[model samples]
Target: MALPDRYTGDDFYCDVAIPSAAQLDVVHDDELVLAYHHTRPFWATHLVVVPKRHIDSFTSVTECDEADVRQLFAVVQRLAREVTEREGAAAVLTNLGRYQDSKHLHVHVHSGPQRDHT
Candidate 1:
């Protein structure tokens, strides 16, 4: 789960217009993608990779989403390399449907032993 919803009940990605780009601690930003530090991190090292355009979840990804999805993964690949090189290992993951707290499609790049986030 993320912070108490500070905005209207909308999928985070779709509301990009609400958060000025300057407010986002963006790592990678382009026409199709955005990668940044997770606002709520579960692991010692965590980063979030998401598309600037809304894509719901992996289940909602379609052939039309191919280019954007590939762009998303490209960001993930670069960040994962940086994380693993720095920490010795890394984990890249994403959730779907009930498993995904936010409806927007995103990937988590993390490192370190798991801990009780709560």
Candidate 2:
């Protein structure tokens, strides 16, 4: 199902713009709007990227937001490249519906050791 035109505004739950002090240095001040690293990373590196604006979800995104989405992905790609150079691989992802926690649209970038094949 699709979301409503007007965001519920409750989507803005996070106030800790940047998760850590080190993150401040790692992420570009101007480029970074908000971020958070996974406590238990599925990969070696897992970080969340969010725009300052409160966007509901990917499906809620409109044609007017194309540039914003492009810019957001550019940042994600840059981070992925950095991780790849440091760890040999990176993965980007996003969730919807029940999978999402805050209801705000965000992307996740993960990198690290490969899972062993049983």
Candidate 3:
């Protein structure tokens, strides 16, 4: 049988509480959101955009969550633009169910060809 896409149920993003400014390859950060390099990247250039406060997933969002939703998208927008300008291309991705390994809300901003990552 094939392995599952997301192995752990752990809230990987929330577990870190954000690494030190030095340890975190942070692309962008604010009170509501964070954009940082993937700890284990599958693309040549991969960044993870997350809400500082947990939101679960896109499907978990609610009317009360409007501000957080906007903030997360704003961060995604800035990072995608910055990466695309530098790399000439970018893609943004998110997943649900088994596709979302971490169980926390996040967006991926990436560019360049895929790479084998640990």
Once fitted onto the true fold, the runs of candidate 2 whose alpha carbons sit more than 4 angstroms away are 1-26, 31-42, 113-118
lDDT of 1 by residue, 52-95 (tens): 87888988999999999999998999999999999999999999
Clash-forming residue pairs, model 1: none
Q: What is the lDDT of candidate 3?
A: 0.83
Better by lDDT, candidate 3 or 1:
3
Q: Cα lDDT of model 2 overall?
A: 0.64
Q: For residues 72-102, write the lDDT of model 2, one tens digit per residue.
A: 7778888888878988878888989988766
- Which predicted model would earn the best TM-score? 3
Q: Residue 114 of model 3: what lDDT?
A: 94
What are the runs in model 3 whose C-alpha is more than 4 Å off?
1-9, 17-22
lDDT of each: 0.81, 0.64, 0.83
- Candidate 3 TM-score versus the reference: 0.86
Model 2 — TM-score against the truth? 0.67
The clash count for each model shown is 0, 0, 0
Which pairs of residues clash in candidate 3, taking residues 3 or more apart in a chain or in different chains? none
How many times do residue backbones clash in model 1? Answer: 0
Score candidate 1 by TM-score against the native: 0.84
